[model samples]
Target: MKSRYILAALLATATVMPVASFAQQSAPAPAAANPASQIPAADKQAIQNFNLTDDVFNRIVKVSQEAKAQGIKPKDAKTDFSKIHSLDDLAKQVTDSDPRIAPLIKKYGFTPREFLLANLAVTNAAIASEAKGNPRMAAYVDQSKVNQKNVAFYEAHKGQINALMNEEPDPAAK
Candidate 1:
């Protein structure tokens, strides 16, 4: 069986994990189930390339809330998606602990340490911005932006990062 299929089966058996954004969040496998009894080819590639699971998406949703609390106006973020790295990292920043995130550590094959560093770097940018008027805050802000940018660089290449997840390298890449 393919890795994607294998991951889907395990998630379907687990039940709590649902593919929320891709399909209506109801139950497991509904996302994969027949809207047409066949998935469109573009969507198939998109789902695989998206490199994120529904559970992860749900967790990432919290980042918007976090952004609000940090005083980053929607316009501020929208004009510069660079502020959040990419759509995926934008979602990843505010994630709290979810039980489903555990099995996904293996299945998704994410580099947790790297991801956490990236997540925190972005969060700290907001934190640093608050300090800009204060000299102490300025120092921290400079440091935070540096951290955020460093992590963002990695995040900026999410397509490449995603290429590594829940998938095997194509023979041609070799």
Candidate 2:
């Protein structure tokens, strides 16, 4: 039960925190220097295969709400949030902003990195689900790349996910 709240917070923060930075972080110098490294290959596949489950998703939402209620806000990050390029980098940004988040998420069985991935997976699945029913939206999503499991989960919990995603942050919680 406590873990569920932590998980929810992790998911919410993971989605909101990383998104801006995910797009802007610099490319790995190591990858550039070692183009053939298995590390990069493994990281790529890990991101592609990060799985999401109902328990994990519930925890993320719970964590997010709990964090908000506690007023456990993240500080300003070091990097331009707009420039974060990878999940690792985004996790770093999130942790750096709020050291407390590490322990918070740990209670829910997530490393910050795992939270970010789960958050992204949920967001992607939501988008893909929406695209499935609307031809105009479907035109934008690549069906082959969408994870069927995630979509199925989203379909099953559309109302809850949408409510969480559309919720406005409480001003007093800031």
Indicate which candidate wins on TM-score: 2
> What is the lDDT, from 0 to 100, of the residue 110 in candidate 1?
42
Please list the C-alpha lDDT of all candidates, in the order they appear.
0.32, 0.60
Model 1 spans > 4 angstroms off: 1-98, 105-109, 139-145, 148-174
Model 2 segments more than 4 A misplaced: 1-44, 73-85, 166-174
Model 2 Cα lDDT, one tens digit per residue, 1-174? 122233344455444432221223244335333222322334445544767788887888777776766666544223443545456766776766666777777888888888777876776676677776788767656565667787788788889876765555566764
> For this target, which candidate reaches the highest lDDT against the unseen true structure?
2
Candidate 1 local Cα displacement, residue 140, angstroms: 5.1
lDDT of 2 at 75: 49
**Alpha carbon RMSD to native, model 1:** 19.9
